[model samples]
Target: MNTKAEQTKGASAGDIGKLTLAAVILVAVIVAYTWLGNGNVPQPVRLIGLLVGLVVALAIGAFTGPGRRVRNYIAESQFEMRKVVWPTREETIKTTAIIIAVTIVLSLLLGLIDLILKSVILDWLLKLG
Candidate 1:
Protein backbone atom coordinates (compact mmCIF):
# COMPACT_ATOMS: atom_id res chain seq x y z
CA MET A 1 0.00 0.00 0.00
CA ASN A 2 3.02 2.29 -0.28
CA THR A 3 2.86 5.32 -2.54
CA LYS A 4 5.26 5.94 -5.46
CA ALA A 5 7.33 8.33 -3.34
CA GLU A 6 7.73 5.78 -0.57
CA GLN A 7 8.52 2.98 -3.02
CA THR A 8 11.11 5.05 -4.86
CA LYS A 9 12.91 5.76 -1.58
CA GLY A 10 15.88 3.64 -0.49
CA ALA A 11 15.26 0.01 0.37
CA SER A 12 15.14 -0.92 4.06
CA ALA A 13 17.48 -3.44 5.68
CA GLY A 14 14.94 -6.22 5.48
CA ASP A 15 14.41 -5.70 1.74
CA ILE A 16 18.16 -5.69 1.09
CA GLY A 17 18.60 -8.87 3.10
CA LYS A 18 15.80 -10.59 1.21
CA LEU A 19 17.23 -9.47 -2.15
CA THR A 20 20.70 -10.70 -1.21
CA LEU A 21 19.36 -14.07 -0.10
CA ALA A 22 17.47 -14.40 -3.38
CA ALA A 23 20.65 -13.63 -5.33
CA VAL A 24 22.64 -16.16 -3.35
CA ILE A 25 20.06 -18.83 -3.97
CA LEU A 26 20.11 -18.01 -7.70
CA VAL A 27 23.90 -18.30 -7.87
CA ALA A 28 23.86 -21.54 -5.87
CA VAL A 29 21.28 -23.01 -8.21
CA ILE A 30 23.33 -22.10 -11.30
CA VAL A 31 26.50 -23.56 -9.81
CA ALA A 32 24.67 -26.71 -8.86
CA TYR A 33 23.27 -27.05 -12.36
CA THR A 34 26.74 -26.70 -13.87
CA TRP A 35 28.15 -29.22 -11.42
CA LEU A 36 25.35 -31.66 -12.12
CA GLY A 37 26.29 -31.70 -15.81
CA ASN A 38 29.67 -33.24 -14.80
CA GLY A 39 27.96 -35.88 -12.64
CA ASN A 40 25.27 -38.53 -13.25
CA VAL A 41 22.30 -36.13 -13.00
CA PRO A 42 19.91 -36.01 -15.97
CA GLN A 43 19.47 -32.85 -18.07
CA PRO A 44 15.75 -32.58 -17.30
CA VAL A 45 16.35 -32.60 -13.56
CA ARG A 46 19.02 -29.95 -13.81
CA LEU A 47 16.73 -27.76 -15.90
CA ILE A 48 13.94 -28.20 -13.38
CA GLY A 49 16.27 -27.17 -10.59
CA LEU A 50 17.16 -24.02 -12.51
CA LEU A 51 13.47 -23.20 -13.10
CA VAL A 52 12.57 -23.77 -9.47
CA GLY A 53 15.41 -21.59 -8.32
CA LEU A 54 14.32 -18.80 -10.65
CA VAL A 55 10.75 -18.97 -9.38
CA VAL A 56 11.87 -18.93 -5.78
CA ALA A 57 14.13 -15.96 -6.36
CA LEU A 58 11.35 -14.11 -8.16
CA ALA A 59 8.90 -14.85 -5.40
CA ILE A 60 11.31 -13.58 -2.78
CA GLY A 61 11.99 -10.42 -4.75
CA ALA A 62 8.25 -9.81 -5.25
CA PHE A 63 8.02 -8.75 -1.62
CA THR A 64 10.30 -5.80 -2.29
CA GLY A 65 9.17 -2.29 -3.34
CA PRO A 66 10.17 -2.44 -7.05
CA GLY A 67 8.31 -5.69 -7.59
CA ARG A 68 4.98 -4.12 -6.62
CA ARG A 69 5.56 -1.31 -9.14
CA VAL A 70 6.31 -3.83 -11.89
CA ARG A 71 3.13 -5.74 -11.09
CA ASN A 72 1.14 -2.52 -11.18
CA TYR A 73 2.70 -1.51 -14.50
CA ILE A 74 1.82 -4.87 -16.02
CA ALA A 75 -1.75 -4.59 -14.77
CA GLU A 76 -2.09 -1.08 -16.20
CA SER A 77 -0.61 -2.22 -19.53
CA GLN A 78 -3.14 -5.02 -19.77
CA PHE A 79 -5.93 -2.60 -19.03
CA GLU A 80 -4.73 -0.17 -21.72
CA MET A 81 -4.46 -3.01 -24.21
CA ARG A 82 -8.16 -3.61 -23.90
CA LYS A 83 -8.82 -0.07 -25.15
CA VAL A 84 -6.59 -0.55 -28.25
CA VAL A 85 -8.23 -0.87 -31.68
CA TRP A 86 -6.28 -3.53 -33.50
CA PRO A 87 -6.38 -3.83 -37.26
CA THR A 88 -8.51 -6.60 -38.83
CA ARG A 89 -7.00 -9.40 -40.90
CA GLU A 90 -8.01 -7.80 -44.18
CA GLU A 91 -6.58 -4.44 -43.16
CA THR A 92 -3.35 -6.05 -42.05
CA ILE A 93 -3.00 -7.95 -45.32
CA LYS A 94 -3.71 -4.87 -47.42
CA THR A 95 -1.25 -2.79 -45.41
CA THR A 96 1.38 -5.48 -45.77
CA ALA A 97 0.86 -5.71 -49.55
CA ILE A 98 1.15 -1.93 -49.89
CA ILE A 99 4.38 -1.95 -47.89
CA ILE A 100 5.83 -4.72 -50.05
CA ALA A 101 4.91 -2.92 -53.26
CA VAL A 102 6.43 0.35 -52.06
CA THR A 103 9.62 -1.41 -51.01
CA ILE A 104 10.00 -3.15 -54.38
CA VAL A 105 9.38 0.06 -56.31
CA LEU A 106 11.89 2.04 -54.21
CA SER A 107 14.54 -0.67 -54.59
CA LEU A 108 14.13 -0.74 -58.37
CA LEU A 109 14.35 3.04 -58.51
CA LEU A 110 17.54 3.01 -56.48
CA GLY A 111 19.03 0.26 -58.65
CA LEU A 112 18.28 2.23 -61.82
CA ILE A 113 19.92 5.34 -60.37
CA ASP A 114 22.99 3.33 -59.37
CA LEU A 115 23.29 1.85 -62.86
CA ILE A 116 22.99 5.29 -64.48
CA LEU A 117 25.66 6.78 -62.21
CA LYS A 118 27.99 3.85 -62.89
CA SER A 119 27.56 4.21 -66.65
CA VAL A 120 28.18 7.95 -66.51
CA ILE A 121 31.32 7.54 -64.42
CA LEU A 122 32.84 4.73 -66.54
CA ASP A 123 31.97 6.05 -70.03
CA TRP A 124 32.31 9.83 -69.61
CA LEU A 125 34.73 10.35 -66.72
CA LEU A 126 37.15 7.60 -67.71
CA LYS A 127 37.25 8.77 -71.35
CA LEU A 128 38.06 12.30 -70.15
CA GLY A 129 40.92 10.92 -68.03
Candidate 2:
Protein backbone atom coordinates (compact mmCIF):
# COMPACT_ATOMS: atom_id res chain seq x y z
CA MET A 1 0.00 0.00 0.00
CA ASN A 2 1.44 3.38 -0.99
CA THR A 3 1.75 5.95 1.79
CA LYS A 4 -0.10 9.33 1.61
CA ALA A 5 3.14 11.23 0.98
CA GLU A 6 4.14 8.95 -1.86
CA GLN A 7 0.74 9.29 -3.52
CA THR A 8 0.94 13.12 -3.64
CA LYS A 9 3.90 13.31 -6.03
CA GLY A 10 4.23 16.13 -8.58
CA ALA A 11 1.34 16.52 -11.03
CA SER A 12 1.83 16.03 -14.79
CA ALA A 13 0.97 18.69 -17.40
CA GLY A 14 -2.32 16.95 -18.20
CA ASP A 15 -3.32 16.89 -14.55
CA ILE A 16 -2.54 20.60 -14.21
CA GLY A 17 -4.65 21.36 -17.28
CA LYS A 18 -7.57 19.35 -15.94
CA LEU A 19 -7.43 21.07 -12.55
CA THR A 20 -7.24 24.50 -14.22
CA LEU A 21 -10.23 23.68 -16.40
CA ALA A 22 -12.23 22.58 -13.38
CA ALA A 23 -11.44 25.89 -11.61
CA VAL A 24 -12.35 27.87 -14.71
CA ILE A 25 -15.64 26.03 -15.02
CA LEU A 26 -16.52 26.89 -11.43
CA VAL A 27 -15.56 30.56 -11.93
CA ALA A 28 -17.56 30.72 -15.14
CA VAL A 29 -20.58 29.39 -13.29
CA ILE A 30 -20.29 32.14 -10.69
CA VAL A 31 -20.01 34.78 -13.42
CA ALA A 32 -23.03 33.36 -15.23
CA TYR A 33 -25.10 33.32 -12.05
CA THR A 34 -24.23 36.95 -11.35
CA TRP A 35 -24.99 37.99 -14.90
CA LEU A 36 -28.32 36.18 -14.89
CA GLY A 37 -29.30 37.64 -11.53
CA ASN A 38 -28.46 41.16 -12.72
CA GLY A 39 -30.52 40.58 -15.88
CA ASN A 40 -33.64 39.69 -13.80
CA VAL A 41 -33.61 36.00 -14.70
CA PRO A 42 -36.04 33.77 -12.77
CA GLN A 43 -34.73 32.46 -9.46
CA PRO A 44 -35.41 28.85 -10.43
CA VAL A 45 -33.51 29.11 -13.66
CA ARG A 46 -30.56 30.74 -11.96
CA LEU A 47 -30.51 28.04 -9.32
CA ILE A 48 -30.67 25.27 -11.92
CA GLY A 49 -27.88 26.80 -13.95
CA LEU A 50 -25.72 27.17 -10.84
CA LEU A 51 -26.33 23.56 -9.85
CA VAL A 52 -25.56 22.27 -13.32
CA GLY A 53 -22.35 24.26 -13.53
CA LEU A 54 -21.23 23.01 -10.08
CA VAL A 55 -21.90 19.42 -11.08
CA VAL A 56 -19.96 19.79 -14.31
CA ALA A 57 -17.02 21.36 -12.49
CA LEU A 58 -17.03 18.64 -9.87
CA ALA A 59 -17.22 15.93 -12.51
CA ILE A 60 -14.25 17.42 -14.33
CA GLY A 61 -12.30 17.65 -11.11
CA ALA A 62 -13.13 14.07 -10.18
CA PHE A 63 -11.58 12.86 -13.44
CA THR A 64 -8.26 14.57 -12.68
CA GLY A 65 -5.22 12.79 -11.16
CA PRO A 66 -5.24 14.87 -7.94
CA GLY A 67 -8.92 14.10 -7.40
CA ARG A 68 -8.22 10.36 -7.53
CA ARG A 69 -5.33 10.85 -5.12
CA VAL A 70 -7.62 12.80 -2.77
CA ARG A 71 -10.21 10.03 -2.91
CA ASN A 72 -7.53 7.45 -2.08
CA TYR A 73 -6.26 9.61 0.76
CA ILE A 74 -9.76 9.87 2.24
CA ALA A 75 -10.13 6.09 2.09
CA GLU A 76 -6.76 5.63 3.78
CA SER A 77 -7.72 8.15 6.48
CA GLN A 78 -10.95 6.28 7.15
CA PHE A 79 -9.03 3.03 7.47
CA GLU A 80 -6.59 4.61 9.92
CA MET A 81 -9.43 6.24 11.88
CA ARG A 82 -11.09 2.84 12.27
CA LYS A 83 -7.94 1.54 13.94
CA VAL A 84 -7.97 4.33 16.56
CA VAL A 85 -8.79 3.38 20.15
CA TRP A 86 -11.56 5.80 21.01
CA PRO A 87 -12.12 6.65 24.65
CA THR A 88 -15.24 5.59 26.53
CA ARG A 89 -17.86 8.17 27.48
CA GLU A 90 -16.85 7.97 31.14
CA GLU A 91 -13.17 8.49 30.27
CA THR A 92 -13.98 11.43 28.06
CA ILE A 93 -16.10 13.10 30.74
CA LYS A 94 -13.42 12.60 33.36
CA THR A 95 -10.72 14.05 31.11
CA THR A 96 -12.86 17.05 30.27
CA ALA A 97 -13.61 17.74 33.95
CA ILE A 98 -9.91 17.56 34.83
CA ILE A 99 -9.02 19.99 32.05
CA ILE A 100 -11.70 22.46 33.13
CA ALA A 101 -10.67 22.28 36.75
CA VAL A 102 -7.01 22.86 35.89
CA THR A 103 -7.87 25.82 33.68
CA ILE A 104 -9.99 27.44 36.38
CA VAL A 105 -7.30 27.00 39.03
CA LEU A 106 -4.59 28.40 36.76
CA SER A 107 -6.73 31.41 35.88
CA LEU A 108 -7.40 32.17 39.55
CA LEU A 109 -3.71 31.89 40.38
CA LEU A 110 -2.77 34.26 37.57
CA GLY A 111 -5.45 36.73 38.59
CA LEU A 112 -4.22 36.80 42.19
CA ILE A 113 -0.64 37.35 41.03
CA ASP A 114 -1.75 40.18 38.79
CA LEU A 115 -3.64 41.85 41.66
CA ILE A 116 -0.62 41.63 43.98
CA LEU A 117 1.76 43.06 41.33
CA LYS A 118 -0.58 45.94 40.54
CA SER A 119 -0.92 46.94 44.24
CA VAL A 120 2.86 46.73 44.79
CA ILE A 121 3.60 48.86 41.73
CA LEU A 122 1.01 51.45 42.73
CA ASP A 123 2.40 51.72 46.26
CA TRP A 124 5.93 52.15 44.91
CA LEU A 125 4.76 54.90 42.58
CA LEU A 126 2.97 56.71 45.41
CA LYS A 127 6.14 56.61 47.49
CA LEU A 128 8.18 58.11 44.61
CA GLY A 129 5.67 60.93 44.20
In terms of TM-score, the best-performing candidate is 1
TM-score of each: 0.89, 0.80
Clashing pairs in 2: none
Which stretches in model 1 have alpha-carbon errors above 4 Å? Answer: 1-7
Per-residue lDDT tens digits for candidate 2, residues 1-129, read 554456546888898898899899999999999988888799999999999999998888888888887787798899888989999999999999999999999999999999998988898876788
Candidate closest to the true structure, highest lDDT: 1
lDDT (tens digit, per residue) of candidate 1 on 51-82:
99999999998888767767878887888889
How well does model 2 score by local distance difference test?
0.89
Question: What's the lDDT for residue 81 in model 1?
Answer: 88
